[model samples]
Target: MGIPGGSAPSTRLLLLPGTLGAGLIGLSLWLGLSHGTPLRCFSGVAVGLCFVSAGIAAWRLRPRSRTGPWMALLGLVVLTSHLNDGLMLPTSMSGRELITLFGTPANWLQVPVAELLFLAYPSGRLRTTAERRLVTGAFALGAVAAMVMLATKTPVPICGGWCGPSPLQLVADPQLYLRLRSVFMTGTVVLAAAALALLIRRGIRSTPRQRRLLRLITLAAGLTVLLFAATQLFIVAVYTGRTGITPTVFLFETLTSWLAAITLPLAFLAGLLRQRLAFASVGTLVGRLEHVAANTVEAALAETLRDPTLRVAFPTEQGWIDVSGHLFHPPSDGSQLLTPLGDPPVAVLVHDPSLSEDRQLLDAAATAVRLSLENARLHAQVQAQLTEVRASRQRIATAADTERQRLERDLHDGAQQRLLGIGLTLGLLRNRVRGTTGRRLVDELERELCTAIGELRDLAHGIRPAVLTDQGLAPALAGLARRSGICVHLDVQVTERLDPLVEITAYYVVSEALQNIVKHADRADACVRAVHRAGWLVVEISDEGPGGATTASSSGLSGLADRVTAVGGQLQITSPPCGGTHLRAELPCA
Candidate 1:
């Protein structure tokens, strides 16, 4: 019978290995308990169970990783090593043949497979060509040694110096077998030591986060190498007649094997559990973020992730900015990573590169805070838009001032100069004309031309005054006082030049107020006061008039108010019935 979906087939395929591993472990246990020592059997069982359980959990957590499957294979290899152990053969003929043919050689694969398992830890693949070649050579050497033992050695012990002799042993010479065993054990020791050294180097060079994850596994690998080395040395001593295999020695060997087996898988599981706990903290972060404010979201995320240097920045029309709406530039030293939070990205997370090792954790944390980030992004974008609008208004005001200055320059330099030249020509003609009537006509024409020139100069000054642009606001205010038709008392305190836009805006405030006084104040005496204080230009115009004037009532005052605001300033007017009118304008100088 088949399962329901396409995934079912793969799921079932994964289940096959789990089932086979369990059965082999069961068989190993039954054989060890019935024919060998019970403590040794339980220790071997514990080792197999640890590898199988850790492998399955790791596989489920990281489905794409090969580390899980390799670990499971290590468990199977350990379990199968003890399946054929016993001093006596099975009563059945077929069972004896099967043990000699397959089970005897399968036991030899455990050492090389275990070494390869450590070499592929965490990532599940050898990182370098040297590592790959080392593991490949170990497998090949182990296979050759297994085959040689079956062909030429007799009375061969399997299952790490317990169990029984090889039923497939062909040659009768025990000395020949000892020499072969020595070579194989020496090779095993060298390979195990190399793998252990590589693991130590990895620990020393790892980042803090990486070290935390690998600490237990590294300890297990180091201990396994020591036990294997000691076991090999003892075997060599026995073969050289320096020692004999007493019951105490046998027990020590059994204990060493069991300890090595159990320690490795338990350490691996412990490391994996630590990593799982790190991932689980993402759930806690979600709960904490339920009530977080938009501005404080960055701090909350950093605290939860345990990365104090973590920063969240949102993308705006004006470029990248932080939660507080200030411009942000990511680091250039490559110490940090940028993870975009959404499609087209609402925000970017700048964090330590170590966090990149677990992309899933980073992604989960980002997902948990995505809504807060979106809100923050929208707020930043709105602020940027307001800033842009203000800048545009200022640009328009500056352009209008520039155009007014141009018109003033054209009138002064073009039409007024031509009219003066005409007057000079008329004077020359009056001298040339001897006729009395002709001279009188020439004088009359000259007088009319002078009047037109004076009118044109006044028009140019009204547009944009040359005195305000050249001399500054004090001279400009003096000019305004003299030009006014009503009695004016002007008090000028601004000595230094201000921004051109500010000066122009201030001049208009006084000019427009004086016009209102002339039209509505019944010729009341006006006081125009200008002062500079605290990076601002303050200009006040007041008149003792029977007044009820305001910016809303007068079109000129309305326009003047707008002009002040364009330069990021304010205009206020206060007028009461039969009382004095006070107009104040505050313009920023900076």
Candidate 2:
């Protein structure tokens, strides 16, 4: 298979092999008919058709592949060998002369073809320099041996089968060249055997992709090798002048040769057709347009190209995006292929560069999902924008939380302490100012100072809530329940400390939900329930009052939604008309 489909030669050159095969077949059949042997005639036609069909199939499958020509050569050469075999039973003096002239020369056809089949089996070339050189030398040597046989007009001895006489001698000393025939035949057979073995070994060590291509061809080639081995054994027997191995073995070997010959070409043709199977999904893909997914084009392209690693990138305003709507980029390296979708190219598929030659499949894949791909592209753009917005909101929330914590700390350690000191000073001065006229004024001023301090402490607590930091979520939640206006039934089922952010999110969800309930639920009664279950922190704040709570524009619930979203948590409010609001929030802790 030395590059089964090589650089395509001239059109005529490509068609020549098929033409030669047809002529050879027709000639062989005519000769068989003249000889009046129906079995021989049918055998010739069948073998001829096998090789010719294989050549045509390979050529059509991959016109540029040299394997097709090699396949054709295989068929044509087999025809030569078969014709030589048939010519032994001559119908004319000319036929006898042709047998004498062409018999041994035609037999040598198998030698180089066998080695060629081994070295370049299905769709590959001779892998190693040494094997290539050996096969070339065998061909050259076989040609020289044929030249010698023709020059001396020497008749090769029958191994196990009969050979007609060669009365026409071009040279006086035919025996001189005849001695060298056995030596050349043996060398050629040995080389063929070595080449075949090496081919098998290479196949065993080849890449899985290459081996997959070998599935059919390997079986056919293996049988052909066995046939050759049997022929070699027959030659060895004849050399020693022993009656060949049992008649059953000889018969089986000969019949096996015919079977192997028939199967090999057909197997190669099958191998060639396998490449086309990659495009079989074209119809299925086109049909899938009715129900195209975001990855329908990509998935279809990947399968059709037989490249599971195939990627489909949709070009966007923000560069490129993947199916998941994540920001993506075409490969910076030249290894990737960028195929734009339409004229105003909404998307481009980044794929392996090796698949560029498979233009038909790629084009079909791109076209198949153009509509869905555009929609998916738009969806991906929206996703990317959402991703950026979410990130921005998360940053804002984090900064807000940091500021709130700073304010809480300042109130607890700085302002709260100073206020306590002023109140203490007022208490100390109260006894001194007890009898003065200014004492009444001092007492009222002290009372106002205490109220101001109380309000300031409440303001700081509202900002960050010191309890949330000093204590944990459940206790802070319990404190919130105690402080709430309405009667709150608090149920805490947390057995483990949740992630800090998750706990914070859950705290805020409950805090805001309850506050909403107090403000808008026309609060008759309220329930604050927080629990840790199944890898999530679940917080529920339900109120038994008029519900109808909509997450109104920039309202309390909307702010809570942003906070919940920032922490990858969810806030769900189930408020029926004039019934009650059941606010549920879930935060993933693990």
Candidate 3:
């Protein structure tokens, strides 16, 4: 059977049966005025119309299910049966005979129609072989009985003691007809009991959600069977002269049977609407999931499904784990259900077993959960890649710093010492020569050697500051400030030593910012400040230079920014349109 919220049914298809049933109801009501009391006529009409309306709705709700057609058919049969009895008012013999031929069969049709409807409650299909066989037998029996009654039965009494003879009676034995009527009535009661038993068994075996949906329809069926059996037994008692059955008892039984009939269709409709509403909540669930975070999807699903114990887990190499990567043990005691969220089962949702009955809801939730899991997995992968890239860059920067220090040491020790020795040799040659031309050449050579040595010292210091290695950040920054041609202000508030990489990154940030200020700001005095806050070393450098400095425009600042990022730090340059440039670097110190 098609589930609730299946494809939309055609309006014209539904209206066809609706129009036919309504016309039959109207015809029955018009005939009822002449044949029965106003209350009795209206009650019967109400029962038939209820069935018709509910049938149309059921048809629209689940077009694939035959339950709607059966219910609508039963209502038409009921309305036609009433019309059959009313046709006795026709005085013409031929007209009466025609009504007898068609109406006799129509009255018997009610039994099999009701039986088929009962067997097909909720889903509209005869689910088992036994149910199918029972319905088939009921139709066979009803057809045979209807044909026999048409051949042997004399006439049936309508309301107000009016009667008409059956022109097609083949047998004149009234006793045989009476006996056969008793048997047919007994068989109907038996069929009702059997149908009741099947419904009861289905209820017992159903899950919680199924039970809820079946509750109303099941109750209506039970009451219908009980009333039908009581009415049949009462009629038998009256025929056999077994007891004094008062008019009051007969009237009450008739009214109760009609009430039960009316409730049957209403109950079916109620159950169908309940199922529709349940699926509607799944739409609400999808909306909720859209805004829900990946880690909290479990809680959102549980709330929407009304299963407080719901859990979402994914299959990992280590075993089953939750969204947060905590080890999870799937329930195995049969108390809960485990629903896979993907075709190949990317994740599993462990929840109340009742939810399994509503596959539409489960499928909708699964699609959302699977998407969420995939998104979270992708996000984690991206973060992992970024972390690895940052670590690699930090390692490369550390190695390059080590090489720079080695080069500085080589220049200071090897090249500077050789040049100083040459300068001393030139000085001794100048004193020994004493001749004017020789002394002049020796002095000029010594002077050239001194200038080369001074330039070498500056080169060594620029490559890697020895002061930065020996005296830490504060003293090195102070010496840098003293060396700058422009005025400089330095402030360092760090009392504890930091990681070597953090210290080096902070030193470069200051050195680079100062160089940019001196080169680009045209002798602007700069301020450099360093403070350690909450495990982070924050360094700020500001210069009174023309603003509009961007990393994209400055290769030096761009490289400096990359260095900060490599050490898992942030670099921000704020150079406004008309004034000073502010550069800030926040590096992890711990």
Best by TM-score: 2
List the candidates' TM-scores in order.
Answer: 0.56, 0.66, 0.54
lDDT of 3 by residue, 14-123 (tens): 88878988887776676557644556667667767777777777777666567887887777776666556533344343355665676677777877787777667666
Ranking of models by lDDT = 1, 3, 2
- What RMSD value applies to candidate 1? 10.6
lDDT of 1 by residue, 171-210 (tens): 7777788888788878888988988887788778765655
Which is the leading candidate under lDDT?
1
Question: In candidate 2, what residue range of length 10 has the lowest lDDT sum?
Answer: 1-10
RMSD of each: 10.6, 7.4, 16.4
Which wins on lDDT, candidate 2 or candidate 3? 3
Q: Let me know the TM-score candidate 2 reaches against the reference structure.
A: 0.66
Model 1 alpha-carbon miss at residue 92, Å: 12
Error of 2 at 373 (Å): 4.0
Q: Each candidate: how many clashes?
A: 0, 12, 1
Evaluated at residue 410, the lDDT of candidate 3 is 95
Per-residue lDDT value at 288 in model 2 = 68
Candidate 2 C-alpha lDDT tens digits along 1-590? 32223344566875787788787788777777776355765675576567656766666556544566666676777677677664334534346566556655666666786667656755436657877888888788878877666666544454223344444555655346545555776776677667767766766865454556556666666676667667666655554557544555445545755775567766665654555565557667677667766645567667766666677666666677787678786668664678776787777777765455446566766766677777777777777788888778767777878888898888879987998898888788887775776687778878998898889888887877777777778888888888877789899999767766676677777778777777776666888888898898888888877778867832888878768888767888888888888888887677
